[model samples]
Target: MSGSWAGGRFGERGECLLAPNPGIMTLDGTNTWVLREPGSSTAVVVDPGPVEDGHLERLDEETGDVGLVLLTHHHLDHSEVAATFAARKGCAVRALDPAHCVGADPLADDEVLSVGGLSLRVVATPGHTADSVSFLLPTERVLLSGDMVLGRGTTVVAHPDGRLGPYFDSIERMRSLATAGEVATIWPAHGPVHDDAGAVLDHYLAHRRDRLAQVAAAVERLRDEGATPTPRAVVEVVYADVDEILWGAAELSVRAQLEYLAERAS
Candidate 1:
């Protein structure tokens, strides 16, 4: 069902449940997902979302017994409630980063975790964060993509914690999985569920490439105009069409791109 606090389910094999946590940094809101095997009693919880009490209560109501709490990344919005939720359910919270994990085990790539006979394969998808990962549910051909891919708009590279090259590689990796028919839908951390996994992944990859090209063009434009080719000036030109609110974020991406370009030039 769709509502202000919750979203509908998708696919016959598993549900694409959502717990919306709308806020400033969250854009619309963070999505806490519940994925269960068809006709199973236990379910796997992905990204427990923020520490909102109401959300935790809703989670309790939605999932009676959680088998595991799997985190895609360590972003606050996605991982803030993991510890609490895991404690409440007496389940383990698994993540790639040990720091973000409470008492649960650290997740590893290629590991297959089973909950109520349903298995999930972990895929390391860093770049959104050094510890980012995606879960592949083969039975449903569904991928639970965390911050690596969003439902609404593009995700920030999150510089310092996130990088451009690895981000591109992660997208391509997801695309390859989709191309292989390993993924039919994407259950992202934010926004609605996506049915066209392959096309969406392709679009995400192409968009990043296009943005890099735009950054290059912006650098060229500034040089032609005789403006200083510093990161700040480059940001002004490359992100001219972007809102001031997002320019700061754009600048980070620009800086990352500039660094990549500089390294390549050398």
Candidate 2:
């Protein structure tokens, strides 16, 4: 909230229109990306964002001709108005999940989508949610990392549909892309855009490892005390310094960590 991340234009092909919905979970707001290749007549929209009147009006102005609407994930904030926006623009909305896609095939891993001479490679970076996916714009060396990587802080590995192991793999995948110079920047869904994709990814991975260790230590101490630690109990100890309003999100991460530990032990 204190940063200069008011979300604006990136390189030549990308422009971010920050949504109006700002809160604890969604930092700033959802970033609606307008992507257009140089000398192209049509634009490709990514994550139409929550259906806000003012935001939508601004977005409509920013993107005069949209050839396609793409969702980073099935998250309501990211995809709730994708269908409506796409319908209004006379374009198809495509996502990994069938329930959210409209008039387009489900996105496949490593699929290259070319519209208006712009190429977007679908990199299946799930684990924030099973339907989560990141787009790799090889031209700009940028990754539109849905909820996998954030600009300000770390991301939550939501339990149930979101698992730790896959999140680990997904981060590693992005890391490889960064190290290989295929991706230099990360355009996250929630926060601002990251120019240092490698550094940001490394920080994200390190934070996860450190938090997992902390959770394991807490779990061990609780077990030694003959107490079975629930997710909330683990959160109480591990995330004592964090805001209580975020304990619910921290609990989700703790649950994922516990599940990872259990799987490792097994």
Candidate 3:
């Protein structure tokens, strides 16, 4: 809330319209991206954010003649207005989850979508959620990372639906893109844009490693004291510095970590 994440135009084909929802979890708000190729009449819109009257009105005005609507994930914050907005624009909504799509097939891994002279490569990055995915604009060298990568801090690996193992694989896949110079900038769904994709991805990986180590140590210490390592208990020890308001989110991540540890042990 201290920092400004007022979304704006970036690269050659993308413009961000920041939503009104701001909170502890949603850094500033969801980034509703309007992507159009230069001189193209039709464009593609991504993650049409929450159902706010003003935000939707602004989006309707900014995004003239939308060719298609793309979703980073099925999170309500990002997809609440996707169908409605797509309906208004007379376009189809597409996501990794078919349930989220309207009048379009579910997005396939490594699928290349060409619309309005712009090309986007769909990269399956299901870690934050089972249906999570990222879009790679090879021409712009930009990655539209949904909740998988945030502009401010590390993203949470929600338990049950979100697994640490898949999250690790997703991060490594993104890192490979950055390291290969295929992706230079990260246009995250929340918070501000990142210039150096490689640096940010490295930080995300390192932070997750540190947290995993801390969780392991906390679990071991608890077991030594003849205590059961519950998710809340693990969170209390590992995320002692984090705000209490975020304990719920922290606990979700702890559950994922515990499951990951169990899997590794097996």
TM per candidate: 0.91, 0.97, 0.98
Per-residue CA lDDT of model 2 for 1-266, tens digit only, reads: 25756788899999888898987878888888899999998999999999776777777777999999999889888988888788888999999998998999999999999999999999998789888999999989999998888778989888878999999999999999999989999999988888899999999999999999999999988889998899998999899999999999989889999999999999
Model 1's TM-score against the true structure: 0.91
Which residue runs does candidate 1 get wrong by more than 4 Å?
A: 1-6, 23-25, 224-226
Predicted candidate 3 versus true structure: per-residue lDDT over 1-266, tens digit per residue: 13787988897798999999988889998999889999999999999999875888889988889999999988899999888889899999999999999999999999999998999999999889989999999999999999999999889998889999999999999999999989999999999999999999999999999999999999999999999989998888888998999999988888998999999999
Candidate number that wins on lDDT, 1 or 3: 3
Which 10-residue window in model 2 sums to the lowest lDDT?
1-10
lDDT of 1 at 228: 70
Tell me the lDDT of candidate 1.
0.81
Give the TM-score ranking, best first: 3, 2, 1
lDDT of 1 by residue, 1-266 (tens): 13333456776555544555675446557777787888888989899888665888888777888889989999888888889888999988999988877677799998999998779999999877788999998988989899888876677787777888888889999999999989989988887778899988988888888888888888888889888788778878767777778877777777777777777889
Runs of candidate 2 exceeding 4 Å displacement: none
